[model samples]
Target chain A: MEAVLRCEGLVKRFDDRAAVDGVGFEIAAGETYGLLGPNGAGKTTTISMVCGLLKRDEGTVIVAGEPIDTSSVEERRAIGYVPQEIALYPDLTARENLRFFARLYGLSDRMDERVDEVLDVVGLTDRADDKAEEYSGGMQRRLNIGIGMLHEPDLLILDEPTVGVDPQSRNAILDSVAALGSLGMAVLYTTHYMEEAERLCDRIGIIDEGRIVAEGDRRELIGLIGEADTVTLQITGADGCAERVAAIEGVESAQLEGEELIIIAHNAGSLLSEILVVVRDAGATVKGVNVDEPDLEAVFLHLTGKALRD
Target chain B: MTTALLLARKDLVQRLRDRSFLILGIIAPFFVAYILSLVAGPVYDYGFSADYAISDETGSVGEGLAEGLVDSGFGAEVVGSEDAARALVDDGEASAAILIPAPSPVGDPPPIVVYGDLDDGTAVVVAESIAESIANQSDAVRVLITETGNPASVGAYLGQEPPVGWVQGDAGDKVLDGITYLSVGMAIFFLYFTVQASIINIVEERMNGTLQRLLMAPVGRGSILFGKTLSSSLTGLLSMVVLVVATTLVLGAAWGPVWGVALLSLAAVVNAMGLGALIGTYARNAEQASQFAGIVATVLAFIGGVFVPISTEPGLFDTLTRISPHRWLLDGFGANSGTGTVVDVLIPTLVVAGIGVLLGLLAFGRRSKLTGVV
Candidate 1:
């Protein structure tokens, strides 16, 4: 798969401080790349440079096989940027806003149809004729996303599209983004929501302090900390079952705390039957079992030593 | 350019929807003009008064000239000597002094010298105008005497009262009435706010996050700026045209020839846009820019003779008025008031437009700041 966006050594500085230092990333067609980081982690700055809205101090941004900068209008045509803030004319109707942006992208031909299609994609078709200011926050966000995709850009860059929106709208936006990716459009999404990245991004780059500290798929990133899933078994008569369960193939350790048996393993869900059988043979009457799996939050914490929300 | 036009079109639509153009551009100016007409009466009622001292050495011709001056609405007093006339002018008792030398023995006419106080520019202009009228009448008498070879008939011609041409001297003969002048002045004054408000929409966009989206579009930053400028110019122009038409039909205010008014209005709009853009470059947000533009527009209107005509007496106020685009715009309209062509207003139009271009260039030098993005 050919890369739709290839950024190399992208550096942006404000006065003496470097906001985005030597950042580089690539996203192939039909892939959703997420830049996950906390606030002030230079995610917006990096995306600004990528969108050609800001002049980079030092680096190169190539979109659709052409070098792009603040002056590269042709190359920018291949990009669709959805800023974190609702970037629509409040006085203009939703359909009017879409048409204005569509014209900016030189999509004048069949603009009405394209605008209608985007409005449907973002689920704002019914309120298309209403002023954007009159719409609810979710409807406005949907319209904002609709504008970015109206031109059918090859690479869509969404800068925290779900920020400040309601949960329902956030899900709707995420669904639209997921649908866009399925349409084979390359997407570069930036967000601090770990679940959103884990759910939608095919490849996630965990960014911290202006650098991608780790980058890979969900499992590969989780593997970096060498964390394993833990299974807890609550039993009424589980005495001395830890020693037997620890001898299991996939179980790393098993310890009995009063009536509860705690077992750590590489694949706790797969070893469930065997571990249960072992415990039963050891005269343990199982009452309940719980399995805890590691997620990106753990990975971010294990890597950055701070919670994702923090 | 096409993208710029599209952007300008969208902006125009937005402004029209808001009705800002109608209120600020047309209705406000017309009401101001109506109020002014009610308060100030007609333009002809406004009068210029000056006192003069005359040294009539050429007995009959000098005394006749002094009488003509009195008839023309000036306070003329015949003094003892030329030195006394000079002393009266020097002491500020007289605005000017007219000294008629003794008739020459040769065929050439004697030179009549008018001494005026330089500090009183209006008085000096009036005194010079009266003196020129007298000289022209004397020349006509000489021609009539030569044509009919009748000194008595020529004497009667000189004895009659000369036309009060000096009343229309400094400001020009075809002046706009109180209502019309105020209408044009208030219209152009409000145009600053209208055009500036439109130009600073970019700052509003930045605040609303639309500027970032515009920057991300396939258009260059220059196109965005140009589009904003085009929209502002069009808005300003539209406002001016509406006011001009409204005042003409509603208040019966004469704004001169259609082409001349059109040219001057276009130039005025461009100039206002340029000034707005320049001010916008230094502003961080829409509110700040509006406050600054309001201050500038008010100052320019006050100095440019918008609220009231500045003293024609040349001084610091006079020099300051010359620097204002408002003054030039009014001058353009005044110059082409009646029986004047577009060519009559070419200088003022060029001047107003040129200042705009210069300010626009200065703003362009700092265009990065105008975008509110670094």
Candidate 2:
């Protein structure tokens, strides 16, 4: 199936530095794609280019079937955008804010219905009558998302929506995004949080220093790191224990820092029992054992030699 | 256009909810206008009078001069001696003393001695004006006596029927009392604040990211700008109209024709909106925008005769009056009855509107350039 959103060779420069340099990605219909990076890693800049808020030095963003043109009302209408900041008018009630945006989006024919539906979708229907300024931060963020989704556009672009949100609210927002994908809405999500990408995105694009360093699904990305599993052992008096664990079968390498012995092994789950026996034989009292499966964080570390959050 | 209207409506609603707008834009102008009108007291006809003491030495000429001063709105008390007249003036009973000698014998005019305290400059000026009128009347009678081949006794005849008749009218029909002037002045002055608030709203949105969100919406940037400006202008126009009407109804302030007031109010709003847009476009942030807006509004208020009538000043100060829309608006409001025509009002009104349109276009162009939004 044709992709709902596609960007090719997007470049945006500020002064002499390229904030978003030759970036490109695509999101198919009903799929959730994420651009994961740290702060100042150009994720917001790239998202801004896609939303037509910033003029790209070079690129074309095709939304739905049409190419993105900031001046074209139709093209802009096809994409729902939720900025990182809560952009609603503080003095206006949530419903009023949604209605105003709905009207601006030319949904005047069913403004009330759309506003009500979006408010319900954001779980703010009960408190919709209160002014936005009276809302808690999480509720305000939810309202911001509701405004973006009001027009039911072909694609939704959320730029770090969960930033500065409480944990419960962040989970609620994540669940909403996952629900949106299940409902067949194409989503382009950008964030600095790695776990958000892992939990919500079907496909992840690791952006670093103005470029997409890696792009893949969870399995494919973790496969890039040679199928290694991390085994961490909390021990007591575990001096000279790393060598003992390294001699075990299926163990590739072992390192001990303080009382924690971490082992990188091939097929670590199958070799855990033998590895523990070796630790015990090495005169170490095992306090705790954790077998960490390959995940995006490991994949990111393998690809960039730095943590995903660095 | 629908988007523009929605945006305008949103701005209007926000402004309505803001209490500061209600106080500054609506209540304060009327309050200030009412206080100023009360301070202006009551209006009266064009006339001046000051008490003058007439001396005993002067005969008919002194009598005729005293009579002329009385006719010209001055109180005259004839005393037996100059000392008595001086005492009357010194005791604050009379304004001045007038001494008339006996009629000229050899066709030489008699010398008149007037005594009063020179410290009272206003009393002195009024006395001088009354004295000048009486002297002119006497000269006219002398000339008539020479020309008409009548006897030198023509002074008595002229005194009975003063040749120089006075027909004074109230200082034009347009009564510019304190209330009327202050009402319009405060309205126009606060109008700058209203328009500045609208521009600051734009700056705030830009700072807070709503501007970008709006740009990303289906609406065009022109529509957003147009909607925002229209709302601000309407807020100013409505606030001014409310203050004018309320003051006129409550305090009985005569602001001339309703249509004239409205047209000028609209023109003033346009001018303010344009200037506000320019300030908004030039400012880097909301704080800078509000600061620049306040400075511009205050400068215009001073130059436009808001605090004091700059037009009354001479030379460059009067010339600088035309630089601000406040001056034109005040001039437009000041026009009434026999003083000005509808055309007179429309010219200044149109000029203000023209300036607003020009500045608005410049602001729009500059906004597009600054944002690089095509």
Candidate 3:
């Protein structure tokens, strides 16, 4: 896959403080690459450098394979940035705000049409006539996102998009981000929420203390935790299903907790079907099933020997 | 969607929507005008002081002298004795005192003793005018020996001619023949000040997080800077328009031809706001920008002679005035009313614009560094 955004050896320092110290990453086309880190972990600083808002002290940020030089206007033109803060003018109505932004980008035709489409995507069509200041917190957040995508640039960078939003709005935003990924738009999504990263990102880079400590597919990161896989089954008709599950291929342990059976396996996927047969022979209804991998949180803790929040 | 037009539109709408803008744009200028009306016109207080006392015992001459001094606005009142008048002079209240000899002759010089005060500058003039008047009266009484001489025949001997010197609109001292340029220059001064404040929006926007939002738009810092400057220019121009009208009609000042002066005012507005943009970018907040603006505006006004003519030498102020936009505007006003030259007006216009462009570049260039708090 062609990498839409490529940053190498990016180092941004403020006086004596290294806000983003020697960081590097890339977001491929049609991928949601999350920059997962705690607060003050240089997530915002790194993103700012990539968006060309802050001149990096030392680095190379290439968007769509073209180098991003501050002297080059076209380089800036190809990038879209949704800041961590709400970026729209509150007093301006959504349509007016959109029109103003479109003009700023030097767009000529279809200004209204582009605004309508973004408003529709964020489900803010009904409230588009109102001033942005009058919108709910969630709606304002959505409008912030709307501004980011207005120009349809190759790389869309969102820095903590759902910071104070409600669950429904968060879900809507995450879903929109997923849709963007599917539409072949490269997205650089930064957040502290691990679940959001796990759910939406095709690849995840976990940053801490101004550095990307680890990055990979979900399982590859999970395997970095070195924890046993958890295989769970909701057996309906068997009395000794947990005992039978312990005897299946690759199963190392078993336990019965209430109506559920949990089998710990060294390699859980290899024995999952065999355990299902044993439960069926015992006449247990497999009403529900769950297979839990070692999550990114565990991987984070294993790599850093500390909780993600700490 | 041309960059300049787009920025101008955004700036226009934003400033129009601001309450502070409305106050500075409309209320503040008129308030200043109202205040100006209160203190406007020539400033003068005619005054006179006396150092003499005719004896109240005789009362008539004393009363006449007192009346003459009071009418000239030099506080004059009769004292009880010569000693009292002398005391008044010593105490600094009276600049001089005249002593009346007993049995004064009816048509003589009166042998009046004149005492003087050391510190008062006006005392000499008062004493001189009083002494001259007394001498003239004595001379007149002698001339009118009886009903022998007719007053018209005596008037021929006591003749006077009008003093000759330069006056503002007279044939000799008539450097400026009208109030047109002065009025236009005042209008430009205020219009420029208000418009300069309009560019304080950049600092306001940053403090309020509006700049952060603007940056997030695909708009970038350069565009935001341009937008703010455009708005400032428009408001400054609008203010000039209102000022020209207010000064011309309300204050009874003229600004020569309409079209040329209007264009001059418009260009001046752009230059003033361009400087305002530079100030706004460097200043941390609105208040700081305002403080800097005050000093800067005063300097610009001084250079331009908004308050007073910068120089008194012939062709000196007229030459140096080229450094200020106010001078350009004033010159344009003169040109239209057939008082000044295109060279005089146009040179200042270009100079003001050159300074404005330099300051504008400094402000906009600093903004790209992005140290503004989010």
Candidate 4:
């Protein structure tokens, strides 16, 4: 897939301190890339430079095969940036806000239809005429996201879109963003929520202290820490079940503790059926089964020497 | 430019929805002007009657002076003696007393004597004016008799008011009457806040984070700045138009020729927008901008003679008034009032607009700081 955005060697300095020093990343078409970091990890600064909102001290940004910078107004049409704050006019209605941004993006043709479509997508069609200030926090967040995707630019950038939203709205926003990837829209999302990144991102970049400390898919990242998935089985009669499960192929080890069998493997999910058959042959009836897969949180901690939330 | 227009349209819609334009631009100025008109009713009533006591020691000239006082709309009463006239003035029955001394034996006209009550300054001025007019007529008669060798033709020139027409000159020192001045002045004084409120919308957007979104749009920072300025200028212009029409209909203010008024109003609006932009450049947020704009507007209005005409004589305060855009606006309006042409206000309008342009340039030069752009 052709890359929708490619930025390299991005450096931004405020006086003597560098906010983003030599950061680089790329997102392909139909891919969702997440920049996972704690607060002040240079995520916003990187996004600002990518969106051409701030002047970069050094680097190059290429969007849709075109070089872009802070002064490149024409080239910016390919990019849509949603800042962390709700940047809509509070006094204007949701529809009006959408229309204003649409005009700003030069989407003059069929603007009303586009606005209505975005309102529907954000689940705000029912209250489109109401002022933004009158909406709930979640609704405002949805509207904020709605505006970012209103132009349907080649690349959509959302900077901590669900930072202050309720769980329900956050889920809705996540779902909305998850659906956009299926439409072949490249999305660049920044967040500290490990589960959000693990769930929605095709590839994740663990950024810390203005640098991409690690980047890979979930399994690839877990492989970096040499961590294995664990599968725990509760049995009614689990006599000698651990030894049988341990004898099975792909099962690294198994231990029996109070009618419970704990098995560890490189890929436990793939070996679950074979291990269950062996448990049945051992005359052990299974009561429950739980699998623990290593997630981005552990990877972030293993890589950065600190928790993701910290 | 199109993007700027679009942003300006959005701003105007927001302002209209909140009704800030209506409240600041129309209602407040009109309400204040109405209140001032009511409270300062007597100041606006230019028609007043003053009573004068006249003693004719020289029967010919004194009688002419008394007739002239009555003809000039003053109440004149003849008295038997100069002491009687003095008594009437002292007793507060008369505003002033005019006495023509007895003719000298040498045959030259004796110097006309006039006694005036110091308390009634208006009456004293009127009495002095009547005495002077009579003396001037006598002097003209004497000159005609000596030069032309004919006393008969001198009779035609006496007791006739000199021809006078209130033509507003290019100097721009002339002003409207009390009620009209108050109405126009209040509208313009409130215009600063109205326009500044719109300019401060930029700061408000920054505080609200919308400005960052605007900057992210595919528009130059200059476009955003121009958009904000366009909105402020349009709001200011609309406010002036509404106030002009409202005051004219409700308060009976005669704002002179249409073309001249329009030119001056456009200039004033531009001036207000320019100053507002300059103030906005230094303001970190809307509230701070509002405070700074208010202080500047109040100070300018005071020195510009919006509340009251500071002075008619040339002095320090009078010279200071020239520095204010409000003074130039008022001067333009005053020059344009009643039968005045555009030429009468051209200089003042240029000065006002020039100040606005200068301030606007200064603000534009600092656009990087204002918008945080490189």
Candidate 5:
């Protein structure tokens, strides 16, 4: 399948410092690619270059087989960008706002149809006549997303769409985003939220500092942890228990957190009894135990040496 | 072009919805114009006024001179003696004392000696005026006595049957009312604020991230900037038109020739918009831009003599005042009366618009560093 978006050696510099340093990625048709990282990790900057919002210092961004040109209005129409900020005229009605963006995109022939379609997709058709400022935060965010899709662009770029939203609104936005991928629109999603990336992305790229550190399917990326499972034990009087657990076979490392002792091993389920035995032998009482399977958060932590939330 | 128009329309609509912009741009101008017109005091006589004394002579020449001066809105009184007339001036009862000497014996007409307290500027002005009036009347007396051989009958002097030819020519009427000047000046001043509001909207959009979204849209950056400038210009134009019409309807302000005022207003709007764009380019945010625009507008208005009429007798201050667009606009409007044509308005209009375009281009260049200027 032809890729909907591709970037190679994207580099953007501010003065002497590189904001996006030689970063590159591609998104195929009908796929959701998530750039997962902590804040200031060049995710927004990289996407900005891809969407032609910022000038790249050294790079080529091809969207739907055309070089990304910030000066070319037609070339930019292939990709829709929903910025991090809720960018809308607060005094204008939802319909007016949509019409304005639609006009900007040169969608004159079927303007009303397109606006109504996007508003319905975002479930804002009922309140289309209300001023944007009168809408709740969630509604405004939905309208923001709706504007990006008005032109039916091949690739939609959403920059941190769910930041500062209520949980219900966040979930609604996530659901809408997840639904977009299934409808055959390539999505380039950028977020510092690990769960959002995990829940919606088909392929994820873990970026740090200013470059993508790793990119793959969830299982393949998580395998970077090498078959390791974390075992958490709620224990009391766990003196020397970490040393005891680390000495057990197949256990790689162990650490204690308050009353909980954590053990990383080759197979946490099989080593649970042994870990408990080791803890008890060290004169500590094991209240409970849990073995967690590898996930993207672990993959992020393993690769970057920092938690996804950090 | 369509994109630019759409963006411009969007800005105009949003500006219309902004309450603060409405108050500052429209309501405040009319309010201030009305209040300032009241503070400017009533429209007094455009001509001058003074008081003078004339001696009671045997002939009717002295009384005739005093009557002519009094009928022309001056204060004139006949005195029994020259000393009493001088006393009236010394005691501040009259501004000047004029003594008509006895008839000439050597065929040369008698001189009308005028006395005044030169220390008092009004007295000096009155004395000079009386001296001029009496000098003109003395010429008429000489002509009458020479032609008709009669010095007692001054009735012919007051009528067209005077010995000297009295051919009269029409004088130009007042250019405009004082209140109208105040209205136009205030309108132009507030129109600058309207332009500032429009340009500052761009900074507000940038701060709110809508500008970034616009950049990502399928429209050239030039289109965005052009649309913004056009919107600012339109805002200024609309505010001015509303002010003009409202003040005319409510305060009875006379706006000379419709086409002339329109053309001048267009030029003023263009000029204001350009300055606003330049200010917006330098300012980092909306608040800063607004503050800077306000200060600049006030300074321009003051120097342009928006609150007070500057003397127009070719001086350094009048030359300096010409640098401001407000002066040119008011000049254009004031010229609308008395056979004024489109060219009178067009000259200032084009000059202001040209200056605006230059500043707008510079502002576009500065703002274009991030993107391309429109």
Candidate 6:
């Protein structure tokens, strides 16, 4: 019943900039915990600490209920790492690379079988014999994940595993990750892409500025900014149409996307009247209107003014 | 497969894949071996062409010896007078002026007075040789004096015969035996170089991130390093065996018992590998490692008799070479010849093994630093 992977007060600083600061989170066995954040938001650094590739400045990492030590060759064995960068030897064929890693993990006898299994899972069975460098971006990413599965570890820690991958390859990777969860492997998936986090993770932890600002079920996180709603209007109004809407009560922020004046508000029912009054005073006509529910993207934008891509 | 062998095999394959390593490892040894044969023996001869104004003071015999030298072997000049001889030697027109004194019989037929600055080894050998030939002639005159059973007319000019009790342990074989040490020493020295090159590959792997991939694979860094050392040492030992056996069996040259010589060479390879790893670890990158390795290996090779014969090295310098792995390997190699034992072979082998492992451990510190050198 213990969390498959746990971090308490983990903080890693490089050059006086906190890459991971006092970050604490836990992912249960058979669950995919996504670390969602923008670039340089400490996701990779946090995962690096978890993988034992980098030491934390201050924190305690418990992998499968055992204390983590940088020197614990045993502790390292329990965690499977797919680094942000492709860490496999480019010169080695996928099968050969898998076998090499398998032997390193001390599983020499049945490596052929395991390599075949992972290659099939990653949809790379046909291309497993090709050198890794010759692989397309998506194939490389798939093979990168296949490397992690070679040992069939209990806890799989993938850091930005799908970055730079084509949509098809990325979708295939997400399916493989979901399959790992079904097999009871704990998954700590880190990515800045919101859709991937929303699709793959059971619980999402929103990390920004080296700290986990909020982490919970997707519905629960969206609930954090429940009052945030996007109201779009087809307004053929005067020059001050946006200004009038901006002054309306319950409207938190407003912006125009081409023909639509998208106003984010706390109350959709009352804000429509206030918006209509402002448009009439400006001698404008309000046409089609739409109100949308809040999403993870809305929640993130409210928490930090910067967009996810920023 | 055993863990170490599996790791070692993979390591060797990776190294072979590296184009630079493949070229250097396969080609460099043969290239060096070919060069050594060409440049091995004496390179320069100190013979002079001088104007001859011979007076032939000692009559036909002096003239006969001089003519015999010019015609058959030693390149010499027959000068007419002492002044001409002095001028020829002084004006840089000649390396020496052989001034044969009229035979002063009683002591040692007037010692051949061949004169020049004496620091040069080749010059010393040539001068001493000329003196010995002249004295041999004088001693013949002494023997004739005894045979005739008379107080000879030139008693004072007669030379004494060489002593009858000349001792021998190894002095008799010095000239001919140098070739033996040259072959053994060169083989030992090349193994040392190859070991350094092996370590450079390891350093290259580490710097290029290949080592990180290799290490992250369930294999420990220790296993990777151990594999490297084993393969590199094997490479060195194999080259020695090939060189030794090729020269001995195919070329009809002898290097001693195949087993003993092979064992000695093998031990030397391990020692070289350890030294190489230590140096490889010392540098942060392959280029730096190769540079440091090359310089250190060169000094060791030069000291170990890859170039100049060790016998000619200054006593202190020769003794200093004992600390080098090259020196120990050569010692073990030399011991393999001339009434060697299992203990003799074991001592050097043990030294190489012990020191190799020790240096390997010291080099392990570099690996420790690299875990987070970034």
lDDT of 5 by residue, B1-374 (tens): 88778888888788878676588778899998887666544321112355677775546667887788778667888888767776777677876676666665565564454555433433443343345445555653221111111223323332123232111000011134555777888888988888878887888888766888788887777788788878887778888788888988988887877787788788888888788888888887789989999999899888886876654434577678888888777777765632335676677789888988888788777874323222
Flag regions of model 2 displaced more than 4 Å: A225-227, A231-289, A293-310, B38-175, B311-314, B336-338, B369-374
lDDT of 6 by residue, B227-294 (tens): 77677876676667667765555333346667777777767766667677777766777888788877
lDDT of 4 by residue, B1-374 (tens): 99889988998888888999989998999999988788765444223467778887666766665676678666788898867877787777877776655655564555444455333443443454456445556642221010011223323432232222211221222447556787889988999988889887877887766887888788887788788888888888888888889889988887877777788888888888888888988988789989999999999999887886554334565577889888878877876763235665898899988999999899888765556565
In model 4, the runs with Cα more than 4 Å from the true position are A248-250, B43-173, B220-222, B338-344
DockQ of each: 0.64, 0.51, 0.25, 0.64, 0.46, 0.21
lDDT of 2 by residue, A1-310 (tens): 8999999999888899999899999999899999988888899889888887777899999988888855667688888998888888999999999888887887889999989888888899899999999999999999998888888888999999999999999888887778888768899999988889989999999988899988988766887878788899999988778998898877899999888899999778889999888888889999998998887877778887888677
Off by over 4 Å in 5: A230-291, A294-298, A305-310, B42-176, B312-316, B337-344, B369-374
What does candidate 1's lDDT look like per residue over B1-374, in tens digits? 99899999999888877887777776787787777766654332123467888887767766776677778766889987877887787777987777665666666565555566444544654555455456555652221011011223323333233223222222332345545777788889998888888988877888778988888787777888889888998888888888888888887777878888888988888888889889989888889998999999999998887886655444566667889988878777876763334555898899999999999999888877887566
Superposed by TM-score, candidate 6 places the C-alpha of residue B39 at a distance from the truth, in angstroms, of: 5.9
lDDT of 2 at B297: 89
Write the candidate numbers in order of decreasing DockQ: 4, 1, 2, 5, 3, 6
Docking class for candidate 1: medium
lDDT by residue (A128-202, candidate 5, tens digit) is: 999999999999999989888788889999999998899999988998899898878999999999889889999
Estimate the TM-score of every prediction.
0.80, 0.75, 0.68, 0.82, 0.74, 0.65
Give candidate 1's whole-model lDDT.
0.80
Better of 3 and 5 by lDDT: 5
CAPRI-style grade of the A/B interface in model 5 = acceptable
Better of 2 and 3 by lDDT: 2
Score chain B of each candidate by TM-score: 0.68, 0.64, 0.56, 0.69, 0.65, 0.59
DockQ winner between candidates 1 and 3: 1
Prediction 4 TM-score vs. true: 0.82
Better of 2 and 5 by DockQ: 2
